[model samples]
Target: MKNKPNQLKYLKYQKNRNKGFSCRRNFLIFGNYGLKSINSGFLNFKQIEAARKTLVHNLGKNNKILIRIFPDKVLTKKPLEVRMGKGKGAIHDWVAVIKPGIIIFEVKYKDYDIIKKAFFCASQKLSIKTEICYE
Candidate 1:
């Protein structure tokens, strides 16, 4: 599924300088288990989709999966060997600015071992380190 915002107030945003730990979405809310990020980074849409697919493939269809993060920030890139002083580059990708202690994915399942394994596989597809958390 596409995870980008349909409309944004600003087309491009400034570089992300917010390094503070995420205060919101740090706790499990919708599910019994979750994958919490350990480091701060930008998660692109492809990585997010890969992780989601891995989770779904490992967990099967009966389980419920909730994606906590969305790629709202736009990343731009200049064409190869482009001249300087050409303003901002065109939008190349979308990413989610993630911070430490943020819950990236949540799952509601009865089996702990299965959930752990699925989360492990999903974490492997992500760019940041993640630990499985349960409530």
Candidate 2:
């Protein structure tokens, strides 16, 4: 771990910012990777981090994991005891609009069985549908 990039891309750019850029990565780097995201929905930054934590724990110190998507869109939520017909809710949390084909995460490990457990734990932390895949 010599040089790790700490840059996080700006989001809240949900309005007409679709320039057809490839946010969802199709190809993978390692042989054993955890393929995720079958359905489309909002994925928060916390979810991404939690999933990565699980992957790292399972992969140990040798393997690598990549997070393919980022949460750029903002989500709103209404407070409790709020009346109806409100204009809009308050800004709650940030999220990325994940699609069906978008790959959320990819991981590589020696033990294949542990990979499944890692992905399963990660998927449980997420709010959308996800699957584990390999090379």
Q: Which candidate comes out best when scored by TM-score? A: 1
Once superposed on the true structure, which residue ranges of model 1 sit more than 4 Å away at CA?
Answer: none
Error of 1 at 4 (Å): 1.9
Off by over 4 Å in 2: 1-24, 29-31, 78-89
**Distance (Å) between predicted and true CA of 121, model 1?**
0.6
Pairs of residues clashing in candidate 2: 34-107, 35-133
Best by lDDT: 1
TM-score for predicted model 2 compared with the true structure = 0.69
Per-candidate TM equals 0.96, 0.69
The CA lDDT of each predicted structure is 0.92, 0.68
Model 2: which ten-residue window has the lowest total lDDT?
11-20
- Output the lDDT of residue 134, model 2: 69
What's model 2's lDDT at 23? Answer: 50
- lDDT of candidate model 1 versus the reference: 0.92
TM-score of 1: 0.96
